[model samples]
Target chain A: MLTKRIIPCLDIDKGRVVKGVNFINIKDAGDPTELAEFYNSEVADELVFLDITATHEGRKTLIDVVKKVSSVVFIPLTVGGGIRTINDMRIMLEAGADKVSLNSSAIKNSAIITDCSKEFGAQCVVSAIDVKKEGDDWIVYTHGGRNKTNINALEWVKNVEELGAGEILLTSMDKDGSNNGYDNELLEKVNNIVNIPVIASGGAGSLKHLYEALKFGKADAILAASICHFGILSIKEVKNYLIKNKINIRL
Target chain B: MPDISILNTKSANFHSVKKAIDLYNKQNIITSDINEINNSKGLIIPGVSSTDTVMQNIKDLNLEKIILDFYSSGKPILCICVGMQILFENSEEGVKPGLGIIEGSVKKIPKLKNKFKVPHMGWNQLELVKESEIFKGISTNTNFYFVHSYFCDPLDEEIIIGKTNYSIQMCAAIQKNNLLAVQFHPEKSGKDGLKIYENFNKMIS
Candidate 1:
């Protein structure tokens, strides 16, 4: 049996780790390379470095940051943002990224997922979705949740899997930074519709939230930011809480 | 003639073997090329430093089909440490799809079971699970070096040829059809380990 993964997501802007309340009010957290090294020592099962500005900046892969983080951290590292082509995926993977997450890119060119998977394998590709409840329907958000796709969140996830995505990083834009908890309804819906592993991101306020995500949502992994970044909770604390709650985590 | 090939990427595992192979080539022991692979006999698949990057690196080098091709040709392939894991359908370390050439999943030795520090780094013993060509002439319970925490669990039990009880009855080696893989590092495992290599050499000879 596979142990459930606990991941810390580092939101990066101009190579610096930044955190915001609901994806705004950006504040510098620390040096990405330094923070990544810290998490690496904490036995973080995996790390995600999202270039929050890459989409707006029209950049390619986060080469320099990826190089710096990959050099120091031996654990699995994933990078997202501005990954538009197979070449971008190749660069990130060559730079030592274990996987590349596609958000806006997947919506723009679904074919990119298939092509990248063929070249780099499905496991190397991840589909990141920022979902927000739009009245009765759960709408999929793209370009960092600035625009809404007409597709339902569950259907969109299914489409990504069909395109050969190995995993789904589902984030609740509405519950993000609210410290409420994960969107169980949305997660359960997506989890049921998709067979691939779903990593619940966005609303992780407490260790209990993580437990709920794993237990109720059946999430294969959880991605947390503020609670972990501001030192309110450490990875060790989170893992300990999960263990006490009878949840499986890499000790 | 057997169609053999080397599978690895630019990871640390790939680096060491690449260095070793470079030394062999510099000494005129062998030539490095896929076509030459068929002439030379058995294949050499090196380990990945961690399970995380295996899929990308393997896909980056276009190794899966190449491996399946070798398997279909009935050539014996030796998977080193993590290389042995490529045989499984999946790994707990990553969400990547394994070759599934062997019917099983690769899982990390449960923390509840592991007494030794992970990465299992150093020489250990291989308690032969059963008698087979891979272990012929080698002592049944001879000690061979090991450095991995994850082991293969074949869906078909008959393929498991050897085991070592460290924290669990971990698989030391496997043989399914023409395919063979070992969780231990043969290149670093010293003489007894080399005997297993010698057996593989004799198979293709």
Candidate 2:
């Protein structure tokens, strides 16, 4: 049986961890490699380095980060944020990143999805969608949640998958950082529509919420940040809780 | 002489495999040169792509003869994921014929009413059916990272050493003399996964 993955997402800016997170007992909390090694020890299925760096130098630093971390951390590593072109993706993939998450670029040019998928295979392409509930359904938001698009969340997910995205990283903007819980309804709907894996992000306040996302929402994986970053709960504790509840976690 | 030559399959990713092997012995080199690979004590063909793409690259690089020559020379070869699939005669995912080093066919994972994803992309347990030097310290039912849609249906069931369950009871690892191949990526399987590389290195020494 394929075990449900528990992933910890690290926000990176210019190759440094964004938040003052002290989750791991490393000397440098901002160091991406150290945090990655710590998480790998904690049995994190995979690690996500969301590079928010805008400058070219910062992106170069990200490549170095990927190289250093991948050399030590022998788990699947995903680098996202600021990946706009095939060249950007090739640079990261060549540097040892197993996968690259496409957010804004995927929306702006839907062809990039097919191009990346064809050039690098679908498994290497992750379609990240940021959404906020409006009226009866959710709407897609780009530019790091600043620009609103008229695209419907459910419809866009299907489109990306059809365009050859291996998986969908659905983050509910309404629930993100809210600590309320994941949008199980939205997750279930997306899961129902597509056959690919769907990673539930946003509002994971408790272990029960994680359980709900996988069990009720039928999510294949969970992308968590604040819960693990702020030291609210350790990954081991989350695994223990998930195991006790009969969840198939990598133990 | 190079300890091991990681075959450049041009499958988009193999550095993780190289880095994993580096922990045990840094003498490995990722190369496409036939002479270097032929001189190495061991060979690892790591791949992550469709059968068609990997096969196309393998054909373009003209690696079939060298791989077959190395196999016949009794130098241990480790094939991973699509690398493992390429050993068979053909695959359902693509039109290109495989190297046919191993007599078998690669079949697509059935949807089964969409109970599981096409690409079995995650950590799954390995049930060892037979002992091999590759899994020296690894235990049965150990989890390993796997990412592929088509599973190899080798005609010789006796060669299978490991089995993992996803859509059905499928072949995960196989051993035929000095050749060892696995559908799962031990490089991305973390600590336990690293043991496989260590064991392979020890086999070389």
The complex in candidate 1 yields a DockQ of 0.07
Give the per-residue lDDT digits (tens) of candidate 2, residues B125-155: 9999998989988899999999888899899
> lDDT for every model?
0.71, 0.91
The collision pairs in model 1 are none
Q: For residues A11-124, what per-residue lDDT tens digits would candidate 2 score against the true structure?
A: 888888977457547778888888898889899999999988757888888899999999999889999998999999998998989999999998999999999999988999
**Model 1 stretches with alpha carbons more than 4 Å out:** A20-29, A55-61, B1-205
Q: Any runs in candidate 2 off by more than 4 Å, and if so which?
A: none
Worst lDDT 10-window in candidate 1 chain A: A20-29
**Top candidate (lDDT):** 2
The worst-scoring run of ten residues by lDDT in candidate 1 chain B lies at B23-32
How far is A144's C-alpha from truth in model 1 (Å)?
0.6
Report the number of clashing residue pairs per model.
Answer: 0, 0
